[model samples]
Every structure is written in structure tokens, then in C-alpha cells.
Target: MKAKVYVTLKKGVLDPQGKAVANALETMGYKEVKGLRIGKFIEIELDGASQKDGEKRVKEMCEKLLANTVVEDYRIEIV
Candidate 1:
């Protein structure tokens, strides 16, 4: 089984990197750009785990280490 995790800043949190990229895009003439945010993507492989178990483990991983729960949110996909 494989698990994919997406970690992103919570809404209302400041994202300096994302802001910088957005500014750069505007400077380069992409005026339509309005907002941006940065995030992390993680992929994990699990051997012999059922889908339920894989999802549970992935959620734990995100809560414990993959995401900063105070300022970030994470979504998980199991395959």
C-alpha cells in the first residue's frame, strides 16, 4: 500500500515564501495572480497493511511529525 500526505499552512497563517513567489509572478507580468501558499507532499510505502490500518498510521504520522498541527493541516490518501 502507498500513502500520500499533503501538509499545508492553515488559513490565516502568513506564508512568506508563498508571498514572495506571488510577488515575483506579479513582477514578471502575471497580473492575474492573486494568492499563493506553499506546502509539503510526502509519500510513504507500507507493506502488507490494510487500507484502514494504512490510513490510521498515516494520520498518526501527520499529527506527530508530518505537520505542525497548531499552524498546519494535513490530508491523507491511501492507495
Candidate 2:
């Protein structure tokens, strides 16, 4: 099975990297972008009996190591 995890900074967390990118874009003439936030997407392959199992394992992975629950939120998808 294949799993994808998306990890993102929680609302109200300061993302200096994102801010810097946004500022650079604005300077390059992309003023339409009012805000920006950076996030991570991780893909993993596993031998799961079913999609449900894959999702369960991926969620656990995110909660345990892939993402910091105190500062980040995550979503898991199995394919």
C-alpha cells in the first residue's frame, strides 16, 4: 500500500519560512498572494492487508514521529 501524509503548522504558529517566500513572491510581482504557509508531504510504501490498515498505520506514524502534534496538524491518505 502507499500512504501520503501532509503535515502543516497549526493555526497561529509563526512560519518564518513561509513568510519569507511570500515576501519574495510579492517582490517578484506576485502581489495577488496575500498569505502563504509551508507544509510537508511525505509518501511511504507499506505492506498492508487493506487500505484501512494502511491509513491506521500512517496516522500513527504521523502522530508518533512525522509530525509534532503540539505545533502541527496532519492528514493521512492511502492509495
Candidate 3:
């Protein structure tokens, strides 16, 4: 099974890295972009997990290590 996790800063949280990238984009002449938020993308492989099991485990992984629950939100998809 393959899982994809997206970990992103919660709305209203400051993302300096995102801001820096946005600024760089403008400097590079991509002026249409006015906002940006940077986030983590992770892909994991599991040998024997069912879809339900994969979802449960991936959610736990995000809550425990992949994301900061206080300031970040996460989503998991199993394929």
C-alpha cells in the first residue's frame, strides 16, 4: 500500500518560508502570485496493511510525528 500525507500550517499561523518563496516568485517576475503557504508532503509504503488499517496508522503517524497538531493540520490518503 502507498500513503500520501500532507502536513500544512493551520490558517492564521505565520509561514516565513512560504513568504520568502512568494517574494522570490515576485522578484522572478511571477507577479500573479500574491499568497503562498509551504507544507510537507510525504509518501510512505506499507507491505501488508489494509486500506482501513493504512488510514488509521497514517493518521496516527501524522498526529504523533508528522504534524504539529497545535499549529498544523494533516490529511492522509491511501492508495
Error of 3 at 7 (Å): 0.6
- In candidate 1, where is summed lDDT lowest over 10 consecutive residues? 48-57
Encode model 3's per-residue lDDT on 8-67: one tens digit a residue.
Answer: 999999999999999999999999998999999999988888899879988988989999
lDDT of 3: 0.93
lDDT of 1 by residue, 1-79 (tens): 8999999999999999999999999999999998999999999989988899879988999999999999999999987
Query: Would you estimate the TM-scores of all the predictions?
Result: 0.96, 0.95, 0.95
The lDDT per prediction is: 0.94, 0.91, 0.93
Predicted structure 1: lDDT: 0.94
> Which residue pairs clash within candidate 2?
none
Q: Model 3 reaches what TM-score against the true structure?
A: 0.95
lDDT per residue (tens digit) for residues 1-79 in model 2: 7888899999999999999999999999999989999999999988846888778778888989999999999988888
Ranking by lDDT: 1, 3, 2
Error of 2 at 18 (Å): 0.2
